[model samples]
Target chain A: MVLEATNNVLRLDANFVDYTLVAIYFVFVIGIGLLARRQVSTSLDFFLSGRSLPAWVTGLAFISANLGAVEIMGMSANGAQIGMATMHYYWIGAIPAMLFLGVVMMPFYYGSKVRSVPEFMRRRFGTGAHLVNALSFALAQLLIAGVNLYLLATIVNVLLGWPLWVSLIAAAAVVVTYTALGGLSAAIYNEVLQFFVIVAALLPLTLVGLHRVGGIDGLVDKVNNGPVENMLSSWPGQNLTGFESPAASVIGIVLGLGFVLSFGYWTTNFVEVQRAMASNSMSAARRAPIIGSFPKMFIPFIIIIPGIIASVLAPEILALNEGKGDGNIQYNDALLILIRDLLPNGMLGVAIAGLMAAFMAGMAANISAFNTVFSYDLWQQYVKKDRPDGYYTRVGRIATIAATIIAIFTALLASGYSNLMDYLQTLFGFFNAPLFATFILGMFWKRMTATAGWAGLASGTIAAIGVAVLSQDALGPLSVGAIDLKGQGASFVAAGAAFFVDIVVSVIVTMFTQPRVESELKGLVYSLTPKEDRTDPNEKNLPWYQRPVLLAGISLVMVIILNIVFH
Target chain B: MADTDKQAAKEKRAIRAFDIRTIIGALLGIYGVILVLMGIFASDSDLKGGDGSSTNLFTGIVLLVVSAFFLTWVRLRPLLVPEGDDDAADAHIE
Candidate 1:
């Protein structure tokens, strides 16, 4: 049944005109990268754009890099299946994360002048923490890169009638070549162009799609009348997949996402930190987050709303649609379905461009970050310590190519995985959540000694991995009910468990361990609150935690009002 | 450092002024506040959920007020040019 439906839908024919245009766009992106090659003479330039990016450019590029093909489908699929609650991840989860990051952590990061998040980890903790962070981050990058490639290939295959591997190779080649040629500068420049194209295509389609589905009012009615409506409205109902129960969702929304996720990703993630590293000044870096937060406020209206409308637009397919046995929608096909059925002639080409833009941007960012880690953190730190800057630049470009090849193969494997968002969250649970806990403790807690940092990381990792392994039936045949909630419950589990374990371990270890030397603490603490160094060098200071506190409060009020009302 | 060096630094301040980037950023914050307001008032008529009642009005008012804080701050903050080389900024406390 699924195959037949796929066969019927996959009959989309891309002629010479469509292929020619896509090919031209690909060439243009590559050309831009090659043109930017002159700017990328040193390793620093290649990896961090020579720190010349202004506020708007960095802000736009930051959002564009994260809004790739995988995120698009994952968000849309969530909106389609889960109802309005999917909106919480962005409104309640991501927005607060961005603001707190801007207010609390940016000063430290911008002030310290660290090349990467893991490099900062090294200065604070030790070589050991740096290596573990570098490795785990690399692994997370691999997963995201692979999924991004799969999304690109899947979209092209479904929409253009190309073979999956053919689409994968073609798409990967263009991004890899450009990224290898120009590095971070090329990636940022291309992201700006791609961001425009993505917004142009998506905004129109969202409006038209909503209009076709009876506008926002009609969409609300259809969803409210649908089977998934109740699940979609509030979280952790029968159809609710993530965020545990309503109580947990409320608390998690308030505490976890409001504080932890915002601070963690914005402040510590290598990819995000890399963006800020390219800023022209501390002020530019500060503006990056504030400017970046603006796009996210409007994105859900275009991205997720279309999914809700899609459910109404194609009620026939959704209702009678026999998805995979596990209940995963062929989510990669959702946007393609919308494009083929709804859009007019020229617009189809535009939507195709938009999807390609998203795919390429994501793939390029992942490969670039992966290469950066391999070159700077791992290679420079451990392998060959004294290479020339130009040589490392060349090697970083080579790592770009290598990372793409690895992702291409892994993407093929990921084809068997179900749903983009769920897969992303599950992977984050095992990897990113632990990293988050360790980074937060490492930053905010003054008495959080090295032993505390390592213990927090170790406990978080073991607990998360244990849950993941146990959920996977690794401990023998469990009752169906025992593992039934693993799909949606895993993220909340990992997030809560990692936080608690890291806190416990950090506190317990800190009791017996000494704080970091005063000199060592100077970089992080002084950076956070500039006045601290002058006020009293010996007195441990917490930066105006009040700013993040205020910002977080504002963010919460915004999310509550937006989600309950607009979403 | 001599008086000459200080004089040189003072003369090199290249038009310390707010520009298009600042305006654009500040405007974007205003737009975010507008969106929150739209969400609140429109919620009653909006399909998503929530009763169109006094509670929503109250929630909406509170959110608009909070968003106003960000909006006002973005507009009010002074533009500060970098004090040295871009790469030097990276070595601020290193």
Candidate 2:
């Protein structure tokens, strides 16, 4: 029964036209890769687009690189489980941090001329902090890359009615081909392409889903009348945060998710930052995240709302949610169920292609980031110090292939969870939360020593892992259940704990150690950097709306309005 | 100086030939045409999801419009790879 229902949802009754559309999309994806390969003459070109892409290109790639497995599958799963509360992941969790990245952090990153995020750590701190960051970041990318690969494989399993292993290899091969051939240029260009394909596919699905459910007001009624209550509105979101009181839940989400997890992921993570760094000019780099935030604001309407629609609209999902349906149908299958039910041939093919694009975009991001760090940070800084530029580019290509293969194995690990978001957030809490803490303190406080940097990062990560383990069932069977926290709230609390511990350790360690010389800290430390160094020179020439500051201000206002309306 | 000028010319040509806007326009245009064809020749069963409304037709037309806009934007205000070497871009790093 479970197998049959899973099959029913997985295999859309797609005809020849649908297959042709998907085939065309695939051809375009590979063609873009081949085209990008022609331009890859140096290591910089392969890894960083030679820092020569325009603002709009990088901006779209910045968001599209993120729209992969996490946004479409994980967030949609969150929407299916929690309803309106999922809006917070965008309004509360992403927009402000994105603006902060554009306004405050991009200057430091682009200005430093660092090859990668961990490389920035090397400049600000030292080798100790750099090694720790590089290793952990590489691991995180592999783990997350596996999640995207596994989901892509899962879709293939259903679509072709093939086994999981075959599908996994097939999906991994596609991402590997483009990234290995063209490197970051391939990934970025294809990402820009995938972005449009994704919107084209998902937007239609959302509109059709809303139509099926009689629009937003109608969805609200169905939800209220259905098995769930208070889903149409976003407020405390008790179920989402796993906190008992409304106030506590709100506090947890704001502090943990909004401030720590969100900023940590958006600002510090190289996957998104690499896109900004690829910009030809500092002004363009500054504008990247700000531009991304506009579309980022409304993405939840299409991605998350469709999940909500599926939850109430699809009988299979409703049954699965109620614990009476097929065993294989979980909240993660929410978007798939909607696609299978609502879309007909030509659009169905496009949706399948979109899903494929999303998964590849996500996995490609992780792979590209992984290879860059592996070659530039881990290899160049430590292992192979004086290799030719061409050698490092070769190393990068080899690393891409290596990461993709390892991700195939990691994909197996990702299959253990039913809802992928919880696991993803847990990993973010461990890596990003502590990293953000160290970054914020070191950037603002000149007194933060190199000793504190590594020490704080190491201890904070341990603290987060410890917290997640202690929380009952949050990490699955290994959890001690010593803490009362459960659900996504545990990750939030873990991130908060990680942030606090890192800050405390950094400060305590800083008091004893000798601070870096002020002379050396210029441009690396905020107060020491010149006013002119941080601001773009050409920015004044642009119109009011084109400027980063004004664009960010407008974005902040729009997000606030969205939050209130949803509440 | 002559070599730099030659290099800059080659770079500008690369930018124009492989402009992202052109790729996006071409892909979207192709998909749009295919989708429009599907919409026109759609069977009765295809309209079931849209409650007899041709969703394919509507989406296809919308995509075509967006595709046209992208292509026109490329023609009117093409992406400019700033002339001269990117040494100035790096000079800002300090």
Candidate 3:
């Protein structure tokens, strides 16, 4: 039955027209990248686009840089399995954190004029904390880039029957060519272009799927009649409620993902923050994330809705091992299956191109972030001091190439991990959960000594890892009744546990240690910063409706309404 | 005279918005029309894939409109070369 079910899923073979469409996409993207090269004249331009991007460009790239291969593939798969519950990652998890970054944290990040997040850590905490962050972030970015490359290669292999190595090398070559030549400017520009391609490709797929599933009403009816319970609900509750797991309690979701993971990634991660930092003005920097939140609010309709439709229409294909026994579902195949079964020849080509765009954009974003951090925070600071400007630029390009090679090897290593998305999130828990705790204390509490910062980070990471290891079912010491909190639940619990550990350790250490001098703490801590330094001057000039705060408020309200309606 | 010309060229290059409009506009316009045509002459097999709907036509039209917007935006407010010191500290870091 399993074999037959797998065979039933449609396999698309691209015609000349489809190939032509993909070729054109490549031409335009590379052309844009090469054109952007003309803008790169300095190390700053190579790494930071000379800090001259307008709000619109940076804003779009800010979100697009994150809409990588994993997000589109993994979220859609989660949507199929979890129903409306998956929307929590966007609404409850992402929006508020983004607004927080724009409103509160941007003043510190952009105001401090730090080249990267680790640089901020160095200034606030000390070099010990900085090295810990820079090394971890650089390694994590490389691992993620490899994961994306592997995922894209797998898709191309499955669809076109091309050899995996061929696909991997081709993708690496294109990304390296554009990224090494154009730097961040090229990456950002391509990110914006990829955003459009993704929307153009996926939006049509959603519409077509909805039409096939008999629109929203039809979808609701089908899901209501399907095997999955509460497929349409977004709120937590009893058996049929959303977030069906006992471990996925409302508090767990709020604290684990919403506060810890979201803030860690959105506020501190250089991959995302670089976009906002490249904005031409302080006001634009503040506005970038807010502008991104608008499009972000509506993304689930395109990515998630198709997954829901698939659950009702094609459950056999989504089932693990083709719906055999108690195996895990092939959740990664969710988006690929939708494209193959839904889109016709010409449109099929366009959609595949969009998928390719997603893969490359994701890889480029990570590589760009990796190169910047390595060159600025690690290399320039430690390896070579007082280097010429052109020297660093050359170093940056070399780093891009070296990182891509490392990423290719990493992608090969990641093949052992069956579920890419779950592995990615678990990795985030190991690093980001503890990091967020340290940042909160450093930013808000002026008394947080550098010793406290380093201690907090170390203890927090150890606690998170310890919890993750113990929670595994093989260990079984921490499992409740039928609920294996060590599985998917481990990430959530570990994050919350790490947060507490960091706070306790940080506070206790601070009391016994001497704080940094007030002179060194200026503009770095919240309480010590002046009013003019904290507030955006453009706020008074812009009308209330056009203000960043107001726009964020509107977005928050919309999310609340969506939760209620879906509930 | 040569120095002045060189300086002007530098200023223009610095001020220009990354020059992506023509590329995006041309691609969208071209593909948008093709999809529009495909939608019009689509066979019954094509319709089956879309669940008996003309999504291609609708999507094509939307793309065309978006392409037009990009073209119009470039025409109305061309990107300018940014002026001022490129490396000035805009924020108070100390």
Candidate 2: deviation at residue A479, Å? 1.6
* Clash pairs (backbone) in predicted model 1: A97-A262
Ranking by DockQ: 2, 3, 1
Q: Ranking by lDDT, best first?
A: 2, 3, 1
Q: Rate the local accuracy (lDDT) of all candidates.
A: 0.64, 0.83, 0.78
In candidate 1, stretches whose alpha carbon ends up further than 4 angstroms from where it belongs are A1-8, A11-21, A231-245, A252-263, A320-332, A416-428, A469-484, A526-529, A532-560, B1-94
Instruction: Show model 3 residue runs off by greater than 4 Å.
Output: A1-10, A237-248, A318-329, A416-425, A473-484, A543-546, B1-17, B20-23, B45-53, B88-94
Scored by TM-score, the top model is 2
What does candidate 3's lDDT look like per residue over A1-567, in tens digits? Answer: 011122324356777767887898999888877888877766777888878888778888999998988789878877887778788888878888888888878888877778888989999999998998999999888888998888777667667767778888888989999999999989998888888878988999888888788888999998888766766886662221223565557776777778876877788888999999888777778888988988987898899888887787665543542344234236556677778778777777788888898989999999999999999889988889776567888999999999999888877766655445345546554778788788878999999999999999899888877776666541243333343454445666777878889999999999999999987877789998887876666768977754767877887898788878877
Measured over all alpha carbons after superposition, the RMSD of each candidate to the real structure, in angstroms, is 9.5, 2.8, 4.0
Clashes of each: 1, 0, 4
True contacts kept of 2: 0.26
Better of 1 and 2 by DockQ: 2
lDDT of 1 by residue, B1-94 (tens): 2345334433443333433233323332332343334434443543222322332233334434544554565568655554535343223124
